[model samples]
Target: MRKFLALLMLLMISMNSTAGLVNAEADDPVLTSEAAVLMDTQSGAILFGKNAEVKMYPASLTKIATAIYAIETASLDEIVDVSEEIEKIDGTRVYLNPGEQVSLRKLIQGMLINSGNDASLAIAIHLDGSMDTYSKNINEFLKTNIGVEDTHFVNPHGLFDENHYTTAKDLGLILNYAMNNPDFREIFGTKQLEWDGESWDTTILSHHRMLKGEIPYEGVTGGKTGFVDQSKQTLATTADNGKLKLTAILLKSEYKRKIYEDTIKLFDYGFAAFKSSQIRKGETFTSGNLKFKASEDLLVTEPVEKGKRIVDKDGILRIQNGKGEIIQAIELKPLIGKKPEAKTETAPEPKQSGLLSVNTILGVVVLVGAAGVWMVNRKQKKSRRFRSR
Candidate 1:
C-alpha cells in the first residue's frame, strides 16, 4: 500500500513537470537562429529553447569544448614546439611559427581570445600528438566528461568540416561546463590578452563585441563568436545580474546582427522570468532518523512562489515548481551525527597524594620546618643548661 502511494506520487510529479516545462517555453522569444537556448548557468535549468536539440553546425563555438578539454587534459605550463600542422591551419592564425616554443596556456589563450586555428593545432599536437588521436579522445572527453550528446567533433578548431557539428543546446552544455572551471572561465571572459609570442607581437582582442564593450549590455560578462560560410554565425554569451547568471547559445543565425539580438533578448527574458534561489549550506531536511543537509549552498532559478521542495525516502530533495515539474534534485547528504567519538575506555588516572595539591604540600612543608626549628632550639637550650651545670 505504501509502495502504491509512493508510485502514485511520482506519477503525479512527472505529469506536473511535463506541463510546467511545456508551459514555460510557450512564450519563448522568436529567434532568428536555426537553433538557440537560454539556461541558468548556476542551476543548469533550461529556461527557454527553440530547436535547441536540432542538429546544426556549431562553427568555432567548438573551441569552448576544446579549450576546456585542453585545460583538464594537458599541462598549462607545458611548452609546446609549434609543428608543421600549425603552419597548415587555414582560417585564423596567431602567427605561430614552426619550431618555435610556446606554453600550452598561451596557445589556449590565442585559440580562445583570437580564435587562432594555429593555436588549436599546436595544443592538439602537444596533448595527443596527432589530430586523429586528438579527435577520438576529445569526442570521448566531451561525451564522457562534459556529458553532452547529439554532437560530434572532427577538429579542435571550429572550421567547416562536414563531420564537425554540434547543436545549440550542446554548445550551451559545453559553455556551461567550461564556465565552471576557473581557468577556462578566466580565459573565456578575457576581453583582451597580450600575445607576445615568437612571431606575434600584438595584443589579441576578443571578437565578442559585448565583452569588449563594442556592444553594451548591462550584465554581459563574457562571450565567444564564430563564423563560416555554411554556419553563418554562432555565439555563446554569458550574463549575470546579482543572483542570476545565464548562458545563451545561438547557432546558424542568419546574420551577425540576428545572433546578438537573439542573445540579448534571451538574456532579458531569463533575468525577467527567473531568479536564483539559494538554499544555504547545512540546511537540514529529515526522513525518519536520516537527517540531511545541503553540503554547500544550493541554487535554482524559477519564477517566484512556484517552487516546491520534495524530500524522498532516499534523502534526495527534488525541488519542483508549483506546476509539478522537478527543476533541480539536490543529493541531500545524509547527516548522521558523528558517533559520539567512540567512547574509548581510557583508564582513570592514578590518584595522587593529598599532599600533592599545592596548599596541602605547602602546609606539610611548613609544619616540618617548624618542628625542625623547635627541636634545634630545645637541643641548644639543653646544651646550654648542661654547660651551666
Candidate 2:
C-alpha cells in the first residue's frame, strides 16, 4: 500500500510537470480590448488573440467586401453615373453629388480611402442596379470565398444596420483574403488619393501613427480604419519583417488611440513572440510519389521559407501532420530564390546518344567487321598453337 501510494503521487507529479510545460509555451498575455487577433498571413497560425470569436460591428471595414465584389464583377475603367439613391446615404460622403460620373476605380478609392458611404451606394447601384442586390451578392461572396461564416451585410457601406456584424477572427480572415488581391491591397493601403477634383485622406492619422512615422514598425504595409458611435473604433493592419508577414485586427475599442495601440501591440507581440518557418515550397513538401504528365519519378527538392520562432527555449514546439499525427524530426531551412538553371538540371535529353549511335548503319558495320576479323584471327592462332603442342 505504501509503494502504490508513492507510485500514484509520482505519476501525478509527472502529469503536472507536462501540463506546466504546455502552459509555459502557450502563455500569451491578454490585452485590454473587446476583441483582437494576430495571425500569420501565410500559414494562418494564430499567435495571440482575445475574444477573437466574439461577433462585433465591423463599421467601414465592410468596404473590404464591397471593394472585392466590385473589383471582381466590374472593370476598373468602366464608367458609372452617380444616382439619386447614392446621394441619400447618411454618413461619410466622398462629395459625389448625384449626376456626377466616375470610373469604378475612382469609386473604389472613394469607398476605401475616404470611407465614402455615398460612394458605397454608387458602387452598389452600379454593380447590381440596387443596394439590395449588391448586399445579397456581397454576403454570398463573403460566405463562399472569404469563409466569413459569422458576418452578414445589410448594406455595402458598414452603417449601424443590425444585420452587419463580424467577429475579430472573421474580419482578420477577410482582410487576409483581401490583401491577396492586388487591387484591393493597393486601394486599402492608400493614405491619400486625389481624383476627379476630389481629394481624400484618412481621418485618424496619429491613431495609425506608424503610417506617419510616429511609431517604429518595420514593413508597415497600409491598412483600413473604422469608427462609429456604436462600434467605437476598429482597425486592420498588415506588417512584414522580411521574414514573416502578420495581419492584426482590433474591434470595438473606446478610443482611436486604443485601437492603434492595441494594433501596434498585437503586431509587436506577433513579431517578438513567434517565428514563421516554411517547411516546403513549389513541388516540395508533398507526401508520397508525384507523377507528371511527361515524366516518371520526377526529381524533387525541398524549399523552405525562413521560419519565425514562436516560442522561447522555455516553451515547447509541436508539429503535426494533416492527420493530426505529430511529425517528429521536422527540419526547416530558409528558402532561397530559385536558381535560374534548377529546372533544366535533370531534364531528359532529347534522345539517348548511345542508343542513337548504335542505330547508325556505319557505326554498326564498323563494330561488326572489327569483331568478325578478331574472331577469325583468334581461331587461326588457336589452331596453329594446338597443332604445335
Candidate topping TM-score:
1
After superposition, the stretches of candidate 1 with alpha carbons farther than 4 Å from their true spots are 1-27, 281-296, 310-326, 331-389
- Could you give candidate 2's per-residue lDDT for residues 269-352 as a string of tens digits? 666646655332332232223211211122111112223222222222234322332222223222235566556567776776
User: lDDT per residue, candidate 1, 170-231, as tens digits?
Assistant: 88888888889999989999999877977679989999988998778988878889998989
Model 1, residue 62: distance off in Å is 0.8
* CA lDDT for candidate 2: 0.72
TM-score of each: 0.73, 0.65
Clashes of 1: 2
- Model 2 bad stretches (over 4 Å): 1-27, 198-207, 281-389
- Tell me the TM-score of model 1: 0.73
